[model samples]
Target: MLKSRPNAGRSQPKQQQQQQQQQNRQPQQQQQQQLVHTTSSHYGLEEFFDSSRNLGERQVKSGRAWRTDELRLKSNSDLHKLWFVLYKERNMLYTMKEAAATEYELFPSPERIDKVEESMANLENVVRERNNAYWQLEVSPCATGERPSIFRRDVFGRHRWHKCSQHIPPYHRNWHFRNTQGPGKTNETDWFFHKYREMKRKHYNYFRSRTARYLRDLFRRFPNADAEYIAELHPEFPQGYVQHLKENHVLYDDPPRAATRARIRPSEDVQQ
Candidate 1:
């Protein structure tokens, strides 16, 4: 018995090793069970999964968007888990959608996409708010320098602008001038400005052509239509425009040709 197992250190029995592996896996199995237990307690997660399951039947199973306060209260692990669940559900829905499209059938619960998207948007907003707050408190400014206020003139050289922020340091009071060159004086020849001018010119030309054509047609339709009234109504009309109509027999009627007297009266008198 003492001389015992000669090669005991060399190799363990297969059955023993199998038993040890089972023992090792027990803790992992318990941990997995705990993970499941924790996930089941999350808010709305079960409902989200349920809605996903009925995507083939329902058309409006999407839940409301998550609010920031609620997200802020959630633990990091829970949020992480939720992200993965949402991701999986999205993939599942997308797969079903593609399949339905291929079969030319309705992929029920179309609004689920919108709901998921809204939730994602809300989540991103919450994250951004928290991130900004954290940065402002801890880092003293955004990762990039404080966002500068911006101002710009409209295409028509008009003042139309917005102020982005108000954290200008006293030393950089001249930052605005440094970044923005060229005086604010109106420059109609600027690319956008010129484009706007050209657009206005084309629009005016179109109206002018249309007005002239309409007036010509009106005279043709009713030779004695109101001319002076129109001229008075549109005093801004070009002087040469109305004059051209008068010269071309457009605005005024022509004089009738003179009638010739018959020579019959003289002939009759001579015969008498």
Candidate 2:
């Protein structure tokens, strides 16, 4: 037979060889490399960046954070899903923010971070409320189904609402608790506690009196305002409290008028 052409039966090109190898790969191997190939707009690490549409935009319009009422309506499973979505969104926003900082670029719509955090806090609070309710219904000894607390001194001698934890022995018997927390009742602590109580009492009294005075003035200024609505808004006050204040304004420390007509009026004597 005639000699074979020089190019006949030659090896396949490098690109064609790679294509054949990829095609011959086992299904398991392909799955291992990538779980599923989808025709999504963004892929891989790009998912964690700002969207293509908003990449260079100065402002991005968005909705407000999810409210507690809205979240409460969702079931546990739905809440779980939303939580992950929000988490991923938070991560993406943070990544973009950090990148901007590194590159001396302005992070657009910084309030997005605040909105995300607020939603997260609301979610946490909702979960806590549900947990507390569940404990109250099924297992709690205390009224709140939570830790019991008392107004007590901290290590620094500062008084606060101290939450008590379960101990093998009573609080008095537990030395670890005592040493970790400050020594409870001594002359020095007693003196400080008394002084702090006095100061707090004075501060509270000042506010209460001031609030009462303001209520009286408002009542006097707007005699026809909805009394029921005002009372509802400031329910801390007794039912007849504002009326009593209006009748006896002098009982409050606030003066009726600091400057009189004689002092503040356009007068020739004052000019002289």
Which 10-residue window of candidate 2 scores lowest in summed lDDT?
1-10
lDDT of 2 by residue, 139-196 (tens): 8645455678889768656768977777788878878878888555777777887898
The TM-score of predicted model 1 comes to: 0.35
TM-scores, one per candidate: 0.35, 0.50
lDDT by residue for model 1 over 1-272, one digit each (tens)? 55556566445776699999999999999999887764345555444343444645746445676777788888667777777776777776677688788998887867777777677666666666766777787878745334545566633464555445444554257565534642344554366666877898999889887777767666667666667777776676776565466446543543444545444456655865
Would you give me the overall lDDT of model 2?
0.79
Error of 1 at 1 (Å): 39
User: Which pairs in model 1 have colliding backbones?
Assistant: 59-109
Task: Give lDDT: candidate 2, residue 13.
Answer: 71
lDDT of 1: 0.65
